[model samples]
Target: MIGNNISFLKGEGYDFCELKEYEYGEDVKNIDWVISAKMQKPYVKVFHAQKELNIKIVSFLNGSTYFGTKKFKQEVITQIASMLGFICVKQGDPFASYIANETCELCTKKSKKIFNVNFMAEQLFNYDVIGKNIDYEFITNDLFKKIHHKSIIFLIGDFFDIEKLDLKLLSKKHEIFAIIVRDKFEENPSELGNVNFNDPSTNQNFEGVLNSNTIKNYVNKVKENDHKLFSHLQDNAIRFVKIYTHEDATKKLIGLLK
Candidate 1:
């Protein structure tokens, strides 16, 4: 069952296992009445195919100092992570997450010992936004290697610093997703007049005149970058979703799931 769930979700192969005979307490929706009738017994249907969906959610949070903008990227990451964790548990999917520090945490389904509200909250609270020279390749590689079966991976970040990413490896092994965090303020500052700019990650100073011309130029540059990013991901068969700090993460995630 576990392997099937993983493989199905990972886009690897189609297979499934027989779920435990429908227990009385199980939701009625899960009961396979057809199989029971065929068997001439009270046995409910269970999937024996390898495609039983076992969900393993991997989220990459932006645990860098530069993420402390008015958008509160950290909070957004935490909320999405928590919400996703809850959803996975609700769906009986085994869940796991990878933080920037190479922390590999997993939660077995309904495992009181493995996961709970407090446990997830602690992981969010203890996360310190520090400046680290993180190798995304290492993280992505580790995730693909350890993740033998199929799973969903959420790579959430501003990606202001990622020079290049090799998603083919990830896409080939697992179903991949990229959640981009963008701030409106960065996109258009002309309305704000002359304002100093600072890089969130490096705290680098960027003193510039936020005049009409500069604003137009910045907006154009941002749009160009967006186009390039979209094209690159699309060409690689990777899905990309954009989330603005001004928008709600729940709405965005739900839309993606649909």
Candidate 2:
């Protein structure tokens, strides 16, 4: 609606409201079939919201996001971002995005436009994550400075390298929700005999043997990293959820909101 007569999707979600008798041409998906059967009449759900939220989705992308056992982490991140943006549009909320890596950052102009939603998703999905890394501390500080007005911000990423995150300052002005997109195999792995692997962040090749002991060590390190990350986020009262690449990102994100 902000630009051309170009059409985009809507009705992805809405705030809950009391149900009423179903009407013709209404979406049957909204019908509470159980309630309708009990009352012996067709009834439909209703949703209402008086306040609009200013929403921002910040994608912390790096080379690690390019891999997934089932569906790539980048794809899951795109799905989550697109769903969140569409929900914002449906609920009449202004939306913006920040797609960043170690070297570059792209911040979109804030608007309640469907084009922005589509464009943001496209950018995230097609983004090249090769030979790149993410600096959580720098990203957090930058966000704190740029996003002035109070808003709801969702940060999505594969938090493999969060040695230290300075989110305390950013959480003061905005309600922060962190979505840690990961692959199941990253945590639980099946050992492949001696093989060569390339470091995604650095693009450096190395030879190593993936044995049970190595897998155990790697998983333990990942667990320790996550423990520290969770502790920091909890200390700041920032709610977070982990979405595996193989899982339904949209459903999980919606559940997090609920």
Top candidate, metric lDDT: 2
List where candidate 2 sits over 4 angstroms from the true fold. 1-51
Flag regions of model 1 displaced more than 4 Å: 1-58, 63-71, 101-117, 130-134, 191-194
Please write out the lDDT profile of model 1 over residues 124-242, one tens digit for every residue.
54666554444566766777777787667767666554545557787887777788766667666536666676554445677756678877887888787777777767887777777
lDDT of residue 170 for candidate 1: 78
Please give the lDDT score for candidate 1.
0.61
- TM-score of every prediction relative to native: 0.68, 0.79
Stretch of 10 with least lDDT, candidate 1 = 4-13
Q: Native-vs-model 2 lDDT?
A: 0.83
Best by TM-score: 2
Write one digit per residue (lDDT tens) for candidate 2, span 1-258. 222111232333365557899989999999999999999999988765344577989897798988899999899988898898898887778888998776436556788889998899889888888888888877887777778888899998888867867788888889999999999998888999898988788999989899999999999999999999999999999999999988877678878998
On the 0 to 100 scale, the lDDT of residue 99 in model 1 is 63
Q: What is the C-alpha RMSD of each candidate to the true structure, in Å?
A: 7.6, 10.2
